[model samples]
Each structure stands twice: as C-alpha cells, then as structure tokens.
Target: MDLELYQVDAFADTVFSGNPAAVIPLYEWLSDDLMQNIAMENNLSETAFFVRKGEYFELRWFTPESEVDLCGHATLASAHVLYEHLDYDDPVVVFETKSGRLFVDRENGFYSMDFPAWPFHEIQVTERVAAALGARPDKLYMGHRDMMAVFENEAQVRELKPDFRLVAKVDGLCIICTAPGLDYDFVSRFFTPDVSIPEDPVTGSAHCMLVPYWAKRLGKSQLTAFQASARGGVLKCEDLGDRVKLSGQAVTYMKGMIVL
Candidate 1:
C-alpha cells in the first residue's frame, strides 16, 4: 500500500527554519502499532494522522517512540495540509483529539491555533534538575505534562546544553526552560528525554504554559515568543483564561508517497 505524506515546517516563514512534521491524511483509522511504526520510520519529532470523523476530523500525534496527548506544530501542519493541499475551502477546521477539541483558523498568513492552557506550580529545584540543565534556574515549576524552569533572561535559555541522559531522570515527560526574551516577550526551549525528541526546534504546546505564566507576570494578555532552538521559531501568543491562542506560519517542505 502507498500512503501520501506531506512534510511541513511549522512556525516558519520558509522551509528548514522551524519544527518539521509529517502529516498522513487517512480515510480510516489505522492500527495503533502501524501508526506508531509509521511515525518511527518517519523519524521526525512528531507525525500527524487524521481521518474524517463526522463534521470534524479525528487527529492523533505520534513521536518516534509514543503517542502524545497534544501537539501544537503538527496540528498546525495538519491544518496547513488541509487548507493548502486537500482543497479545504473553510477558513476554520476543527479536530477531535485525545486532548479534546482543537480548532485552527486561517488568518492572514498565519495559522491560529486554539489550545488549552496548562497550569504549573512552582517547585523547589533539585540537584538532579540542576545537573541535567547544567545551570540552575531562578525558578522551577511542575505541571501535569512538563516541568518549567524560569531563568532571568533569554541568554540563559538559549545557552543551555542539557544532558539528555540526565534529562530522562527529571520529572515530567519534558522540561521547559524559559526566560524574558530580548527581542520578543519570552523565549523557551523544550527538551524531552521521555520521547524520541531530544530537543524540539519549535514547540507550540510549550507556549500553552509559557503564555499563562508570562501573562500574569507581565500583566497583559497578549504576548510574543521565540523558541530558542537551533532552528528557531517565532509565535504570536494570547492568554484567554482557560485557553491560549498561538499563531504562526508553516511551509510545505516535501510531498511524496510512503510505501508499506
């Protein structure tokens, strides 16, 4: 069998600048193992698979190792594929995901994604955490899906070189290190030892936690963010109480067929 695959660089104006995701448009649900294997073969940070489900589509995200509850960049890439490749005429597309309902709308040149805001609480920084990050953060917090380390400035977040082996020992599926940006409102880098992604170039989901924290501290609802990865990403962010809006652009990188 042959499957159509589209690789998209999300949160980027051009190709090779942001997080790249593989999108497979399916007509029906494939077996869990098959999807996971497909994601592993693709070997990207995340691979998105979607099928038409009633009025909206059902979406799932997989890393090389496991399926995640939610993913931001892949969702944006999926929406981009629909609007640009699948000839979707609607301005808005809704998806049913494990994380619940997700909506993406085309506005200007950016794809605006509505995602649930994650809540994290301040935690005492541990020696293990310090060792993993190579530097101690000004503040540390714990959340359901990730642990956040807040630094004093953007340089601290950008200069990090975490030990992925030690990172695996850290609590939570991933670690988010952030600080006030020099050019933008905030800057962040995501490291995941639990998944196949050692460092995500541009993680849109991390902004769900970053936006809320910065909004309360900055005393505003609207913000901008820069992910401090090698392939950096810029995002327009907004905090809306229980939800957050993240807007960015995507570029199609490769279109091909996957033979199974």
Candidate 2:
C-alpha cells in the first residue's frame, strides 16, 4: 500500500519555524501498531491520520510512543493538507476526534481552529515540581496533559531548564511554564519527555488551557500568545465560552508517499 503524506509546519507563516506535523489522509483506519510505527518513522512531534466520516473527518494523533486525546498543531497541519494539497474546497472543515468535534475555518492566509477550552485547577507547588523545572514558581496548576507553572515574568519562562526525566514522572503528559510576554499577552514553553519530545516548538492544545486562564485574569476576549522555544511560534487566541479559537499560519514543507 502507498499512502499519501504531507509535512507541514503549523503556527508559522514561513517554512521552517513552527511545529512540524506529518499528515496522512487514509481511506480507512489503520491499526494502532501501524500508526505508531508510522509516527516513529516520521519522527515528528505528532502525526495525524484521518478518514472521511460522512460530512466530518475522523482524526487521530500519534506520537512516537503513544496516541493522544488532543493535539493542536497537528490538527492544524492536517487541515492545511486538506485545504491546500487535497484540494478540499470547503471553507470550513470539521473533524470528529477522540476529544470530540473540532472545527477549522480557512481565511485569507490563516487557519483558525475551534477547540475545547480546558479549564485548569490550582495545585500546590511541591518540591518535585520545583526540582523538575529548576526554578520556583509563584503559582501552579494542572491541565489534562500538563502541569502549568506561572513564573514571575517572561524572562523567567525563557530561562528555564527542565529535567525531562523527572518531569516525565510527574503523572501528566508534559510540563508548561508561562509568564506575561513583552510582545504578546503571554509566553510559554512545553516539555514532554514521555512523548519523546523534549521541548515542543509550538503547542496549540497548551493554549486551550492558557486562553481561559488569561482571558479571565486579564479580562480580555482576544489575546496573542508566543511559544518561546528555540524555534518559536505565534498564535492568535480568542475565548468562546466552552471553546477557544486558535488562529495561525501553516507552511507546507514536504510531500511524499509511504510504501507499506
């Protein structure tokens, strides 16, 4: 079997800046082991697979190690493939996913993803948490896949060096450290040793938790977010009651076929 594949850099207007995800549009669902092997071969942060389901697409995301419930950038990348490469003429694309229904809208030069808002609950700052991040956090919280630590400022967020092995044992998907940004509303970094990604360049799902927290704290509906990894990315964020709107640009990097 030969499968069509596209590699896209999501949340970036340019070719090489954002998080790279491999997209495979399959006619039917492949086995879990096959998908894992494909993701491992691609060696990207996430690999997205989709099969058409009536009017919606059934989407699933896999890392090198495991499959995840939700993934932001990869979903954006998949939408890019559908709209640009697959020649999907629709302005709106709907995905039926493990997390539920996800929608993406195409505009002039950007794609906006409507994702579920993940509310965070406050947590105590423990020594293990502090030791993993190599810094003390003023506030700590937990989301579905990560532990969020709010630092004093953006500079602190940028300067953090995390112990990935320790963080992997923290009983979550990853660790997110964030602070107020100078150019945007907030800046963040995502680290997940459990998923084979040491630091994620741009994370869309992380902002789901962030948009709600900052929207309530800053009392604003629309905001800008920056992921402060070495290869950085910018995202436009909006709060929509139960969901968040994440808008960003994607660039197609490569195209190929996988032979099995």
Among these predictions, the greatest TM-score belongs to 1
lDDT of each: 0.95, 0.93
Task: Note the residue pairs that clash in candidate 1.
Answer: none
**Tens-digit lDDT track of model 1 for 1-260:** 89999999999999999999999999999999999999999999999999997779999999999999999999999999999999997878999999999999998889999999999899998989999999999999998899999999988888898999999888899999999988999999999968968899999889889999999999999999999899999999999999999999999999999998
Give, for candidate 2, the lowest lDDT window spanning 10 residues.
165-174
The reply for model 2, stretches above 4 Å from the true place, is none
- Cα deviation of 235 in candidate 2 (Å)? 0.4
lDDT (tens digit, per residue) of candidate 2 on 190-210: 988888999999999998898
Each candidate structure's count of clashing pairs: 0, 0
lDDT, candidate 2, equals: 0.93
Query: By TM-score, how accurate is candidate 2?
Result: 0.98
